[model samples]
Target: MMEATTQAEVTAYWNARAPAFDGVASHVAQGGVWRDVLAAAFGAGGPRDVVDLGSGTGACALIAASLGHRVRGYDGSEGMLAVARAAAEAAGLSVSFDAAVIDQAAIEPASADIVTLRNVLWTLEQPMVALAQAHAALRPGGMVLVSDGLWSVAPQFRSTYDPALAARLPWHGGLTEADARRMLAETGFGDARSWQHLFASPPYPGDVPMFVLSARKA
Candidate 1:
């Protein structure tokens, strides 16, 4: 289990990479994992009260809102949250953005029908704790979705990222499919499953996997 990430480091890292991250997002929406991730997460469900954790720039949150899900986005980075707010406004959608860590977030328990933790599991210092918090935030029979997969093959990882990006990459908690499911289950989630699409072969982006870990409060 990883310890809590310092706010300063996380802020500095994201602050420095904000522009690069935004550029990547635009590119992803054009032809990449962004659409697939959003589709897999929201396309199958009806309108839901959704929370997009680590929702940088409101891509998923805005999309979900457009699909009629009342969405709230959470992130630890203020700079990122600013971008998300602007994006939401530009889309003419109303989404509540929370600038806080998962555990420290002010959201009450059993308030949301679905809680989204996209591309954040592997980046968190305390993934299990984050899942537990998400579980608590959702209503009975709510859902939690986690997505990640920057690298599928070992040698291929080197080709995708340079040293700085590689070093500061979202999180150190990257787990395989089995471990990911196990983490959710261990943290009080039921019916955990992972789905993935490997787009750029092994030497590029690897697999953009989706882990939808859902549970009904018993």
Candidate 2:
């Protein structure tokens, strides 16, 4: 299990990287690809309430807000939240960005229509706890959208974190679509589904395998 000290280390690591985080293609709002992908996953909806956990730089949160959804984004790194808030202001998008750990975010139960975890699960110390939090945050029939990749295969994965700390993360090596689906189901979600075509031609290098998983609250 991840200790409180290790969690603080993880947050510090992310805070150090927050400034240049958006330089990565996948971390920013990619013209139409991300917008379209989120729209499809969110389904036909009108101004739904969205809670974005691990909302680094507010990419997905901003996109969701732009699509008319009311979005609240939470991240453990204060530096990241600063960047996200600045981005939201620049985009004229009304998104509330707060500092909070993924698994311990202070959100009201069943208050959200959608919860998003984009490329965040693999880095989490307790991904199952985060999923449970997502489950509790969503209203009945609400959706949780998760996007991540087989980051272990990427050449730079080893350099992204401290070797010792990385070794402790449950999914630091990465996870598959099947793993995500199973986790969602185990967390009391139903109608779980996955998609891969959205990342068939990744914008970044390494050709890391990516997937998008969406499931409804049971």
Candidate 3:
């Protein structure tokens, strides 16, 4: 099938929408539960470096920074990085921005205490490859945090449909909750545990349905 993901198209899509993404993003999320979920995953603070994948606008990175962890948010979109960098500066936070896909570079193996894949796993044509890379990048005791959901099969993506936004995404994939845990466990993430919370935003079903996941590497 059309390579489920088109990186160039997805990058362009995020680039154009980067500036305004954060403003509208929160409303779409479930009261920002993922932040708290991440906090719980890695604990408050310690010696840890977190790799936030597809970290558009650097929301998660900034949170980790605030909690006193070295944070790096990587994205292929320079525009998105620009926006994230600006926000980090405004918040007086220190988060390094890396400009590349996870698989494109040689990440320091076993250097990270936590690997973050928020909302990114479902958008890749090579989720397993990316997961393996993330696994390799984590320290022995490190962890991988992933959060996305089952894609739209019912009525299949109707509302929340913004032409400007929709035009930006090249393609999308939906991951089952079971597989989220399976990938992490098989990739050598010791004691992989799945976290699922129904985020109902009082009304919009599509915008609120999401899950945040984390798996620890042995």
Q: What is candidate 1's CA lDDT for residue 57?
A: 66
Q: TM-scores, in order shown? A: 0.78, 0.94, 0.81
Total clashing residue pairs per candidate?
Answer: 2, 0, 0
Model 2's TM-score against the true structure: 0.94
Which residue segments of model 2 deviate by more than 4 Å? Answer: 29-31, 157-159
Per-residue lDDT of model 1, residues 1-218, tens digit only: 23344445655666666555766543344434545545665557677888888887666787778777888899888888888898788879999998887778888889888787766776665677788888888888787777554334433432233444445544443556676777777877776644454333321244343243444443
- Model 3 residue runs over 4 Å out of place are 1-5, 27-32, 44-47, 153-171, 198-208
| For model 1, the run of ten residues with the poorest summed lDDT | 198-207
Candidate with more favorable, higher TM-score: 2 or 3 = 2
The most accurate candidate by lDDT is 2
Cα lDDT of model 2 by residue, 111-201, tens digit: 9999999888888788999999999999999999998878878857332678888877889877888899889989999977775576437
Candidate 3 TM-score versus the reference: 0.81
Could you give candidate 3's per-residue lDDT for residues 1-218 as a string of tens digits?
11324666667777888777866665236436655556677775575788888788887888778778898888878998998899899989999998887677458888788888876766565677788888888888788888766556432442223444444443244556677777777777766665554332422345535566777777
lDDT of each: 0.66, 0.85, 0.70
Against the hidden true structure, what lDDT does model 3 obtain?
Answer: 0.70
For every candidate structure, what is the RMSD over all alpha carbons to the true structure, in angstroms? 4.4, 1.7, 4.4
Model 1 stretches with alpha carbons more than 4 Å out: 1-5, 30-46, 150-173, 197-218
